[model samples]
Target: MTTIADRVRELTVAREPFVHATVVRAQEPTSARPGDAAVVLPDGSIEGFVGGVCAESSVRAAALDTLRDGATLLLRVLPDDTATFPDTPGARVVVNPCHSGGAIEIFLRPVLPAPVLGLAGGTPISVAVATLAEFLDFEVAASGDYAGATAVVVAGLGKGEQDAIRAALDAGVGFVALVASRKRGAALLDELALTDAERARVHTPAGLEIGARSPQEIALSIMAEVVRAIRVDGLASSPGPAAARPQQAVDPVCGMTVLVGPETPHARVDGRDHWFCCAGCHASFTAA
Candidate 1:
């Protein structure tokens, strides 16, 4: 029998995105009770059990499904060979078991680690962008902490700004924004050996459609664009099939993934449907 502390440590240290299936409550005749724990790996492997073989099997499969969604889940195993489901992120499976003759409730919550968004800047405007991004929930870490979405916005790309952008792009940050004059942009583009497509990804004058002038305004615009990019790229699931069409294929530029169907975003590149998530991505692709 594993100690609760050991199971708890496993839950904390497991290196992949996963879910937690814990026997939160169980009937007297059930095999599980509060504190009984299990670690649901990204591959759906399970460490501990809260129920019989049949019930654990159900939990294993469900854990994988939840991992695919990058969402948390809660499950309950019922007695009488009839599964009773909870109305929340929980589910119940019914099975007649010899050991656990009663119903057991388990919580399956997904653990999605925060993505690292490295905002490489030190200017007042850059500081504002950092603050706004944090307010909006993008992980703000150092430039070297490139675990997830490493987006680098070159702050007012003046004489000293190239180092930051160079470091960020070299680190393979998916998103790069350049806040510089068009002349400066031209110079940087010429200097960097990055491919045309890679060069195109850089947002020279970063921000949304809103015309921003002040530091706060510029920050808001840049943040809006970041939010747009995040909505377009981040996450495993769409808000739904409507707000966002499911996309198994993603557009690298705008970060929209078009689902496989008639609703997919495709661009006619040399008479071929270059699949895209939006016209913006298509345009970026063509421009590149």
Candidate 2:
């Protein structure tokens, strides 16, 4: 039997996005208890139980919102009488209309797909950026071949920086940054003579203004901006889908991530190929 932890690992490895919801508090007449958990899928189906159908609906809605915004939420579903829909920072409140007459507090944590972050240089600052990005759950690559990168940071010591930047731009990377001094970055941009639209895609200075002094601090600043580009600014405008999106599928029986391939064991259900990790998984899915 695959445990929930095992399922989570499979999802992370396959880069499939989902939400993990834990019941931290459950009031009287509730079907859930503290520490109860559920995996909420993109389609609002839950693999585990946090509460009854009423509470599950609320969890699914909040989970979808967290996935879309990439934000953690502390959700409170309260009974109707005292439901004021309190406004709090980093928290959200929803009333359970099922009138279960029970209050439940569930913490929803989003497990989003890791975006590829490409670093063009091998400098100390670039290395630091990769380290920090990995810590923040970004798939970091230190090469010019940003074939799977949604964001690219160019800081090569005048070596292959231009080529990297051009390739990222041509590939329609969502965010392209040049990690250079203000003046030098400006001069390089002038030399590139990119179209206004293309230039808009490049972030000169490549980071927030934090008055950073050391390479590590500079890298931190750049990565902060990179996150904003993907989670904040990038979502504000419609973007064309990049070529680097990974193909992923979810196992209906165990909620594990399944890589679609001919060699992998699979079954065609409802006119779609449902891949599985092993023969056991396929059998379990078929039985279900």
What's the number of clashes in each of the models? Answer: 10, 0
The lDDT per prediction is: 0.62, 0.75
Give the alpha carbon lDDT tens digit for every residue of 1-288 in model 2. 776667778888887778988898888787889998878767666787788755765676678778877788998877667654446687777764343677788999899777888788888888889889999988887756676577888886595777788888887676788988789888888888889988888898888999998989998999999888766666222234322322456556545444444555689988987876456677878888
lDDT of 1 by residue, 163-282 (tens): 766666565666777776678787876787678767765777777757788888988987777667666766221111122222355455543333434644466767766665444555
The stretch of ten residues in a row with the least summed lDDT in candidate 2 is 237-246
Best candidate according to lDDT: 2
Q: State the TM-score for model 2.
A: 0.63
Q: Candidate 1: RMSD over Cα atoms?
A: 15.9
TM-scores for every candidate against the unseen true structure: 0.63, 0.63
